[model samples]
Target: MHHEAVGRDLSRKVHAAEAAVDHALIEIAALTAALPEARMRAGVSGVTGQSAFDDLAASLSDMTRARARLGGAHRTLAALARRMGLGAVAAGPMDKPDDQPPLDGSGGVTANMVNEM
Candidate 1:
């Protein structure tokens, strides 16, 4: 098969993966918000459901690591596509344009950002 065909197939899979990841993150967010609400509804103090809240926080941490790993895989696939001479192909939806200025116009300089470098 041609490289273009392979790139298309990869692109489709990437999009699907991104969607699944996004959905899982959304669900996690919902649960994170709901736990506090549930605790409040139960007329309990914050300490009452501390254990469950801790577990949920741990799960979120695990999911974050998984997300970072997936992001790395996405970058690797992009590099492969370029090496295959497929040029720039759409892999998945981006939350925002990389070139776009940050709302504060600090260009991330003032932001507490994580860097792999």
Candidate 2:
């Protein structure tokens, strides 16, 4: 394949990866916000769906870790692209600047963090 073709393929893959990460993080956030509302809807009667809540929390934590790892992989891929002379390829939209601290190692951006920005 031509160099331009290879670069285009890499850029397309990067965009897809960014979208995946963004969607996963959004889902995680939604779940996080929903848990409390769900518990309230259940009405605290001693049984507060504690077990389910605990499980969800664990799942969210795992997802956060996974997001971090995926972010690292994204960064590595960006580095590889740079080495290949692709230059600075923008993966996706970022509301915050690069200098801002990431919510986690994931480096994943979301509108939820806009207040922090």
Candidate 3:
């Protein structure tokens, strides 16, 4: 009976952890979703060719650059984890680029690449 109670306690702990991770992921999604509009708004304001827009424009641009730096950090940490056999690469080479042509020498036009033109 004591063992069963301990098992139940562990199961509840796992469920709570999973729920917390899910909530964090949802919050991350929300923040990324707002980036595009902020970028566009800042760009349009900056294009007035006026000096007054400089600070806000720079900050908005920095947000994107900072996000890119964060991505690099994430990749570096993920790679380190993979080297230690902790996790797999999040984006493997087998994940195809949408607009790339095939390298098989089939002399075939890739539809996605052709569509871009």
| Top lDDT hit | 1
lDDT of 1 by residue, 82-114 (tens): 556554455455543453322233434322111
Model 3 worst lDDT window (10 residues)? 87-96
Winner by TM-score between candidate 3 and candidate 2: 2
TM-score of each: 0.71, 0.62, 0.35
Q: Candidate 3 regions off by >4 Å?
A: 44-117
- Measured with C-alpha atoms, the lDDT of residue 102 in candidate 1 is 20
Tens-digit lDDT string for candidate 2 (12-87): 6766876786687788778867878877887875466677767767877887787788778866765565456454
- Mark the regions of model 1 whose C-alpha exceeds 4 Å error after superposition: 94-96, 99-117
Error of 2 at 61 (Å): 1.7
Ranking the candidates on lDDT from highest down gives 1, 2, 3
Clashing pairs in 1: none
User: How much lDDT does candidate 1 score?
Assistant: 0.67
Give candidate 2's error at residue 95 in angstroms: 8.3
Best by the TM-score measure: 1
lDDT of 2: 0.62
Residue 76, candidate 2: C-alpha displacement in angstroms: 1.4
The C-alpha stretches of model 2 lying farther than 4 A from their native spots are 44-46, 88-91, 94-96, 99-117
